[model samples]
Target: MNKSNFLIVALVVILGAVLSSVFIVDEREKVLVLRFGAVKSVKDEPGLAFKLPWPDTVVRYDDRILSLDVEPLEVTPLDDRRLVVDAFARYRISDVEQFREATGAGGEQAIAVASRRLDSILRSQTREVLGSVSSNDILSSDRAALMLRIRNGAIQNARAVGLEVIDVRLKRTDLPTDNLGATFERMRAEREREATDERARGNEAAQRVRAQADRTVVELTSEARREAEVVRGEADAERNAIFAESYGRDVEFFEFYRSLNAYRSALQAGNSSMVLSPDSDFFNYLKSSGGISAQ
Candidate 1:
């Protein structure tokens, strides 16, 4: 509780404060110790560490996984359609010195640079490949393959910054409003014209079919009439032949029979009567109604 006790407590506090500057590396992190703004020790592992107080500093880096989303790049499709594509990139720092130099300003600055690099690569690849693709192919599929190439390109560019890009993925790809309108209009017009042509062709074909059907109907009707006339004439010819043959069998009897048939057909109805010779078959028919008594 005296002056010596006060000095002792003050020294202990200063020593504790200086000891507080010691570096504590975690198992999940890597650290680089700098003294007087110069490289001291690059601790790649975890556990306890030491550093000069105030004049010495420690910079810890997570060698763990980190994700960065690059800004969207507007690219032209092979068919000249503009597409806005967004991509995400994943990376990790593998080398401490390389990372330190690469991330001069910080990981954030390094990420920004890498993002730019990715954007450039994506834009280049899209412009080169997608610009020459057909509209059908572009509409049907992703022609650019921006993510894969961009990831590979970013890793190559990021090597100087000590970055290990794990993967690159295209998050979104969409047509720009202007390009969308134009493309849609073109497609719609194409489809509409096709529909119109199809309708016209169908109508023409229908007309042809109707004309052919009508022709068939007329031909069938004419053929039926001709067949009916032929059949009637054949039947009439047969009847005449039978009559002729019967007459040829008995000439006089046929004459008498004909005379009687004529009288019956020509006779007036009611009280009207016919005046014929007594020898005629008319009188014979009038006398004998039982067909000459069959004797």
Candidate 2:
């Protein structure tokens, strides 16, 4: 080969070697330099990185936060209530060397393996933490506290796989279909008991009011009857006194007046027939023109 051609080929080989040795690390990724299947160095910052060509290799891990949705799982709480729970988790790669070692793969393959491990950890922790509490706690605002416990537990287990758990959350919680009917029946029975107690109390109050009203009516009616009897006695006494005064003034005229009154009373009935002697004193006023008795 000519010297010029040999020089050109040498430059080309050098340029290819330089290009192959250079790599990029972005803000979202963490990189590891492995020497013959052994981790040699880690690069986390965003910049250019370099390594030997051929024998040295680079592996990447996503440093950004990642999400995983857990499938619905059945859990039995302290109260023995069976609940179906759906949950999710947020995480990130915190240790690249450990991650690569644990997964035995890099990049997308490592991510897939890590995700499965994370999901399993979350499921185990969820079951453990939630099972220690009652269903009421699971359904209440205190659920935030429970989720924290779950996250902490998952973080401890996930360190082996180089994962840092950010947070764990329960997306949905519900009674299992097998327990729903019984739960609803119990709730219905409780409400019915409350309603029955309320009705009984209302009926009792009504009876009390009615009794008081009846007592008030009886007292008022008795007082009214007593007053009427007293008024009637006073009126009778006054009328008798007037009659006595009239008799003292003129005996004959008083007797004639009384006779006229008796005749009016006896004859006032419509279509009434009297069977009495013609000399009856009751007829004295009718027989005499001057209203005097004809005895």
Candidate 3:
């Protein structure tokens, strides 16, 4: 070969070797340099990285916090109420070297393996923590504390997989669909019972008020009638006293006045007619100024 051709071939081989030995670590990723299936170094900082060429390799993993949505799981609380729980977690790769070792895989497969194992850990912790509390606690505002407990538990187990569990949260906690209808029915029945009790109490109060009002009305009417009778009797007694005084003052005049009242009452009828002799005793007042008999 010519010297010029050989020099050009050597320069090309050198350039390829340089390119093959170099890699980049992005700010969003962590890199592992492996030689013959063994980790040589880890590059987490964003910049140029180097590795031995041929049979040496580079593996990259995401450095950002990752989110995982857990599949809905059924749990029985301390109250023995079964609930369908949907949860999610936030995590990150804390140590890439440990992660690669624990996962026993390289490239993207490591992330998948770690995720499966972490999911199992998280689910177990979730069931354990949630089962220790009642359904009311799970459904109440205290759920934040429960979630913290779950995250803490998962954090402990996650270290084995080189993952840092940042947070765990319950997206939804609800009665199982099979039991939801029964629970609603029970609640409705309870509400109805309360309403019935209230209605009964109200009715009892209304009856009491009505009975009291009726009794008051009867008492008032009876008192008013008694007063009227007493007043009528007093008026009758006063009239009789005046008539007795008139009789004592003039006996003949009182007799004449009485006769005149009798005559008026007997003649008060419409179309009245009477049959009497001219000398009847009833005509004594007409015959004389006094009520004495006219001889």
Best by lDDT: 2
Model 2 residue 282 lDDT score: 72
Give the TM-score (vs. native) of candidate 2: 0.64
Query: What's the TM-score of every candidate structure?
Result: 0.52, 0.64, 0.63
Candidate 2 local lDDT, 1-295, one digit each (tens)? 9999999999999999999999999989999999999998999989999999889999888899999999899998897878899999999989888888788878898788888999999999999999999888998866889999999999999998899999999999998888799988876887899999999999999999999999999999999999999999999999999999999999999988887677677677593588999888777777777665443
Model 1 local distance difference test score: 0.70
Model 2 misplacement above 4 A: 186-295
Ranking by lDDT: 2, 3, 1
**lDDT (tens digit, per residue) of candidate 1 on 223-261:** 999999999999999988988998999876776778777
- Give the whole-model CA lDDT for all candidates, comma-separated: 0.70, 0.90, 0.88
Q: Which candidate leads the pack in TM-score?
A: 2
- Assess candidate 3 and give its TM-score to the true structure: 0.63
lDDT of 3 by residue, 1-295 (tens): 9999999999999999999999888999898888898998889999998877788899888888988888889999886878999999999999888988888775678668777888899889999999998888998876888999999999999998789999998999988888998878866887899999999999999999999999999999999999999999999999999999999999878888888898888887584588989989888877876349444
Candidate 1, 174: how far from true, in Å?
1.5
| Error of model 1, residue 69, in angstroms | 2.1
Better of 2 and 3 by TM-score: 2
